[model samples]
Target chain A: MAETVDAGFLVRWLVAVAEAVDREADRLTELDSAIGDADHGANLKRGFASVTETLAKEPPASPGAVLVTAGRQLVSTVGGASGPLYGTLLRRAGKSLGEDGEVTRERLAEALDAGVAAVSQLGGARPGDKTMLDALVPGVEGLRSSYEAARAAAEEGALATVPLRARKGRASYLGGRSVGHQDPGATSSALLLAALADTARTEEA
Target chain B: MSPATGGAAAPVGIVLVSHSAAVAAAVADLARGLAGGGDLAPVLPAGGTPDGDLGTSSELIRRAAKAVDRGAGVALLVDLGSAVLTVKALLAEGDELPEGSRLVDAPFVEGAVAALVTASAGGDLDAVVAAASEAYAYRKE
Candidate 1:
């Protein structure tokens, strides 16, 4: 399990996320319309598109640089709370990774834990808050084992949000009305982790 | 810090953040207009996205904060939701905004007026912030 990921691998991972967001934007918006302001999908779509564009224009030199650049791009372009929250997540993770030329699975897991913590701190949210943390907390925990495990855990966490009343973000305004709908942020978080898992699997193959 | 000639302390600067570029600018103008005819303090507006859409942008806020920083601390007044969140993100980045900068929780329009009047009178950051926050208790009935 010592397979290492370089700058190129991180770029591929972000591109994968961009593609996934593009493919699922409508579904994400549908989820948001149920309990939120209905801009999560568009916001994420723009943010990832900028990430893809920025990476192509001038690729970063290391895994840390890659994540940092993508995170900053998201913060500047997303135009919503997701922008800063996701930006802080990737930026903190990149900072934790330092300027490593290649990152191992265990190292990436540790970095992701730091990233998730930053998100939680920025949002002041816990795992039961029906926010992205619902999926992200479990995803980082599972990453300590296998990529497949992490992906599965993230999906489960996202699905689990359907029954929880919102305690954070715009959705919280709806109170019990938010219970029946799947959390858009958690759902998007699952997509992001799934892309990470796919990228790791491809690298291993 | 006081001037070499022992003049009054530098007045605090003010910044307004909002989702719409026009709203931030309008609010800033309103504050300045109502601040009375004195050596007015710097009141800058940072609103909307780079695309000029209806959302806050750190870049715009960054530029506004920098432009209005005059050795005195900067006081930020923000509109609802994303405006506050985006400014908080910049503040958390540390070094993105000027030192002693703070986000004051107050009503958008009324707070801006109170803050600007206090700042123009050479009020320190604390006085400026208190004025804005105290605007909430003003009876409108």
Candidate 2:
């Protein structure tokens, strides 16, 4: 049953993110090299590595603090558009959770929605813009049903970005040339959601 | 954001944010030099990643804005896309930057020159931002 999750659950989710990003780095970088800058993989890997380190060193009391700390670390470390975009997602969602030690599934869903909205507001992007929001919007929406639904929706959203012309970010500069390439941001966003769903299923403690 | 070093009010401050640390620092130098030296307004560069790589750092931008702030407001000139987003992120942080500091969308070099020159002459924030923005239309043949 979808019940409540604790800070340890969030930490496990982030650790899953670090592992996923590390494993998928080459693929993400390959996608980026096709349409945008080629640093996406390395940037995310570095950011997640730092997140792993910080969460280990000085663990936060609440899930909100964990996310806020990780997000701020990414903002400080990562150095690209992804840094702020992803950072805003975690930070806003964390803020929405409001220092809760354990959060219900419904609350987590709402917080994630807020996080996605913050990303949209920050980047001025929509689903069709071929951005991280492409995955995130649907991912958070599907969380209303189940974790598996969210993961499937996010993967589908990422795949949907392949043919869309980028209307935002550095990829937009490529115009028609961007059509055939899958958006790296969308790809990484799906990875993040997958980490969440996986964490929820296996790492419940 | 203190009011100048001495006396009442000083010229509006300027910050050049570029993806390259060298570019930001050099632009600050170029603008200050062209504006008859940076004796009046505070001109600083917030650029590069934390590791001094080619990317914008919000922490760097925030620190530079704070450093250049002189109670007259800070005018930030960004070089490229991510640089703008980084500043926007810092602005979203709610109090990371001093009050009255704003990111001005203008050509990197020309805007820096115009902004610093206007600021050096003790221009207000509005005037300095106007000068930088107006530099977008500066004719080049």
Candidate 3:
């Protein structure tokens, strides 16, 4: 089982995510530009950077607070479609954190469900929309299944984006042209799931 | 996103240095995806706003600096050239930037990861960003 998360660990966790985004931001944008706005990577980077800034101003007392606050920040800072979607993910997950300072498997599962639901509500897009939802929905489900399972599911979801026609967000503007390209959101979502698996494995040892 | 700045009640502030926001979002997705029920830190980007470029990331640093607390200064990690100059401009622009705030230019990819890993290992934003800056050496090599 994962050890209880402390403030330092939580900070690092958040930072790690930022770093991952930084590394992949260009790729995400490239995928997005192919079918969508091309701003997904940049937009998300900005939103998270803002979240980091906001959090620095008022560091959360617990893990839940941190996620929730970051979520809220993302929603507000990110102007495009993604801001709200990602914002919901963090906000809902944060809520599940409850008053407890630490995170547990059960709590995380519940929080992730809430996050997924929030994304569903915000985007009104289903699993096959060729959006991040494609990756995210499966990712949360995978987390429940097992870290490795979730990672595999997420990867599958990301690849599945290849044939999808965009039904939501900027990519949808492309019509049939969106068919051959993979959804940026789904691709990034898959990466996220994969990263989580990596983190779990790395942390385990 | 929010412009609110620091005080005793603030959180540890973070600086996000990337080529653009799209990349930033990807990182956020990665962060969210990897979240195993832990707290993810707040990070603001030094560049790319739908409205404008934030007029040289220096402004971003200035604003970010004031946004946090005494110990929580802005930490910078950039994606490319001129961003270094931009950060310098921001630092030179005024006294508003907290003494705690400093620029961290690490290899874009490796720096972010190293900083993050360091942060996970119990380093502060300053330390994490610093580690990230060190990773910039890889770019030089």
Candidate 4:
């Protein structure tokens, strides 16, 4: 049977992302301390917390509404590049989802691709720049297959970011020192994708 | 402040978006001083995260941009990093600003002062944005 995504699914996915971000916040911050500000974990934690709370309070009627609300919360709550970047990702994707009652996996993939494109356009950082695009690009590509595959691709892309010289964000300020450090944005992005995959799996089970 | 001819508000308003709220406010103050410390134009500071920490907030930028807009339009001057991203995100999310508002890519401080001075003199939205953009090519030498 084909899997479908709904408003409830999006809400659960956001909750899973929040939980994952909370669990990995310390590690994310530590990674950022190497080449960028050491607030990646805390920032994401706070942003996702607000996202969950808003989701509960408003209870969007559609998947697009859920994603848009989550994105808005992130944009308002998170105090770093990650806020707008990730917020744009979800918001763009949500906009692309249209007003469909249930979204197919193919539609989800296409929307995710749009979201990743928005991140690239907003930040002007391509895959090799060692930003969130690193994980997001691959994650979108992996969506063509299975959620599990997308999760793996995102994790791999994030890991691949290590050893790349920073070319964007605060890490770029470090120049050569930015080399050999995994990008915090990419790491957190990967974690968020992984949470999405986990949510998919749980729903299927 | 005396209104313009026909009792209309200023032709242009200004918004300073920075990573630090204090920085945004300070720059607005400096720009206001350059505009003769009078209410020549509305200058709003939209900076920092919602919690008052360092970082840009798109929500804050949108609110400030709206607050300063007086039917003519608003000029947005942004600092480095996510301040630009936040504004871009705001645009991408379809949060429409008042008609004639624009984001000018110029040095934050210099562009703001130039834009403020021009707007204070009754320059239109396009002219104020031009002033800010022209600051990009300004040479210190």
Model 4 TM-score relative to the real fold: 0.94
Candidate 2, pairs of clashing residues? none
TM-score of chain B of each: 0.92, 0.90, 0.63, 0.87
Between prediction 1 and prediction 4, which has the larger TM-score? Answer: 4
TM-score of each: 0.92, 0.94, 0.58, 0.94
**For model 3, what is the alpha-carbon lDDT of residue B67?**
54
**Model 4 ranges with Cα > 4 A deviation:** B1-9, B37-39
Q: Report how closely model 3 matches the true complex, as a DockQ value.
A: 0.02
Order of quality (DockQ) = 2, 4, 1, 3
Docking class of 2: medium
- Per-residue CA lDDT of model 2 for B1-141, tens digit only, reads 343433345668788999999999999888877888446588999888878899988888888898988788889999876887778877788777887788897899999999998888887788888999999887888
**Model 1: per-residue lDDT, tens digit, B1-141?**
332122356667799999899999999999989998979989999888888888888888888988887767888999976787777777877778987788998999999999999988888888889999999999989
Per-residue lDDT over A147-179 for candidate 2, one digit per residue giving the tens place of the 0 to 100 score: 889999999999999999999999999999999
lDDT of 3 by residue, A55-166 (tens): 7788888888888778667655664556656766777787777768777655666788888886776566788888888988877887776778888988888998898888
lDDT tens per residue, model 3, B30-121: 54344334554455555554455422234444565555333545566665433443444335333436655666756665665665555444
Compared with the true structure, the alpha-carbon lDDT of candidate 3 equals 0.65
lDDT by residue for model 4 over A123-173, one digit each (tens)? Answer: 888989999889989988998888988899999999999999999899999
TM-score of chain B of 2: 0.90
A-chain TM-score of every model: 0.98, 0.97, 0.90, 0.98
Per-residue lDDT tens digits of candidate 1, residues A1-205? 3388899999999999999999999999999999988888999999999999999999999999999889889888888889999998998899999998999888998998999998888778999989999999998888898888889999999999999999988898899999988999999999989999999888767
